[model samples]
Target chain A: EAGVVQSPRYKIIEKKQPVAFWCNPISGHNTLYWYRQNLGQGPELLIRYENEEAVDDSQLPKDRFSAERLKGVDSTLKIQPAELGDSAVYLCASNERGRNGELFFGEGSRLTVL
Target chain B: AQSVTQPDIHITVSEGASLELRCNYSYGATPYLFWYVQSPGQGLQLLLKYFSGDTLVQGIKGFEAEFKRSQSSFNLRKPSVHWSDAAEYFCAAFNAGKSTFGDGTTLTVKP
Candidate 1:
């Protein structure tokens, strides 16, 4: 089976510009997650989805970051007027519900804000 | 809140040498532990996990981790390091369907 798929492996944009990242989780997976990984740091949770419902998104920056999972399969993360500090890798992961928390991750979308 | 800590930011080992990467966690309940590896420009891959029985868990790529409840630690070990083992390793704690990751440790294997 194919792993989680993310589009636009690399992106470069200027500050104050809007950028979006897309992800398609593994087939039959019921949970999806979005995480951000800064250089030299581990991945941090941005949002999590159980099917089409976003169950945990408290860590997401509401002012500039927004995410949505449509039909409980594909997800999109958008950053509007992104700041220079937003340059990092956006990782998408998924797992089967109640599977002891083993996650399968994608190659991630690397964003560079200049 | 649950969290994980990796004290070593970087480690160097010669090929064929033994390797150990330390991880410490803080949680209120029985912790679900995991170890993941990330190569340059790649996504994180599960190495091993410790959930219930068996303090020692074996995983892919000749990796193993031992869970010590007394120490609140789950350390990854390899008897002999390989050049391909050079990558970033992350320790994580899982609870309520979410995971908290530690700052990873970068491993460099010298030939």
Candidate 2:
């Protein structure tokens, strides 16, 4: 089975532009997560979804960030009027129900806000 | 809130030499620990995990980690490093269905 999949491995846009990232979790996985990794740092949780419901999203920057995991399979993360600080790698990960905290991650989308 | 810390930002070792990366965590509950490796332009890959039982757990790519509850640490080790082992390694602690990762240690294997 394929691992989690993410699109647009790399992206470049000017500050104040809108950007979106897409991800398709592994088949049959019930949990999905979005994380942001800055240069030289480990990934930080942005949001988490259990099926169609977003279980945890308190870490997400509501001012410009939004995310959805429709149908509990695929997910999308968007940033409107992106700022230079938003430039980072957006990672998507998934886990099977009842699994012991093992998360399969995608290659990640690297966004550069100029 | 639970958190993980990797004191070393980077490490260098000669190929075929033994290697170890330290990881420390702070959590209120029994910690589910993990080690992940990430190559350039690649996704995070699980090396090994420690949930319960034996303190020492072996993982993929000849990696192993020892969990010490007393120290609140789960340090990764390899008997002999290979050039391909050069990558960023992250130590994580899982809690409440979420995992917290450290800053990551970049390993460089010298020829």
Candidate 3:
């Protein structure tokens, strides 16, 4: 079985520029999540989607960050005017329909904001 | 609120040596504990999880974790370390609608 897939394994952008990452979840997974992992820290959830509907997005920066899962299979996370602090690994994960199921993760997209 | 704590930031052990990583958690409700491993430039992989029943849970790659409810700890251990096991490990606690993860522990294996 294929695991979650993400694009642009690495990205570099200057401050104030825009950056985006994409993720493709495993087949049949009903829930997808986007998380940011900082240096020496565990991943922090940015958003969660139950199918195509976003169920949680409290940690996302509303001013500059936005995410969408239009087809419920693939997702895109965008950060406009990226800041230096936004430099981190963006990890995409998915789980079964049940909330307590284990999550499967993609390799992730590492972004470097200068 | 739920939270996890990994006391050690980094641990180094020679190959074939036993290894143990400490983790603690805080939550008001019945806790769900998890362990994940991340290799360099890779995503996090589930190791094991404990929701209820047995305190000892076995995971992939010869890993195991013991959940202690009274102490609020879920510690990961391995009988022998391997070079391939060098990576970062995270402890997470889940309850209610939210989950919390520890900072992480980086394991270094010596040949």
DockQ of 1: 0.87
Decide which is better by TM-score, 2 or 3.
2
Candidate 3: which stretches are off by over 4 Å?
A99-101
lDDT per residue as tens, model 3, B1-111: 567889999999999999999999877765788999999999999999998999999999999999888898999999999999999999987665455789999999999
The digit string of per-residue lDDT tens for model 3 on A1-114 reads: 989999999999999999999999999998999999999999999999999999989999999999999999999999998999999999999988865737789999999998
The candidate that achieves the highest lDDT relative to the unseen native structure: 1
Task: Give the 10-residue window scoring lowest on summed lDDT in candidate 3 chain A.
Answer: A95-104
Range of the 10 consecutive residues with the lowest summed lDDT in candidate 2 chain A: A94-103
Q: Model 2 chain B, poorest ten-residue lDDT window?
A: B91-100
Misplaced by over 4 Å in model 1 are none
Q: lDDT by residue for model 2 over B1-111, one digit each (tens)?
A: 678999999999999999999999999976899999999999899999999999999999999999999999999999999999999999998887788999999999999
By DockQ: ranked, best first? 1, 2, 3
Model 2 clashing residue pairs (backbone): none
Misplaced by over 4 Å in model 2 are none
Residue pairs with clashing backbones, model 1: none
Residue pairs in collision within model 3: none
TM, chain A, every candidate: 0.98, 0.98, 0.97
Per-residue error (Å), model 3, residue B50:
0.7
Clashes of 3: 0
Question: What are the Cα lDDT values of the candidates?
Answer: 0.95, 0.95, 0.92
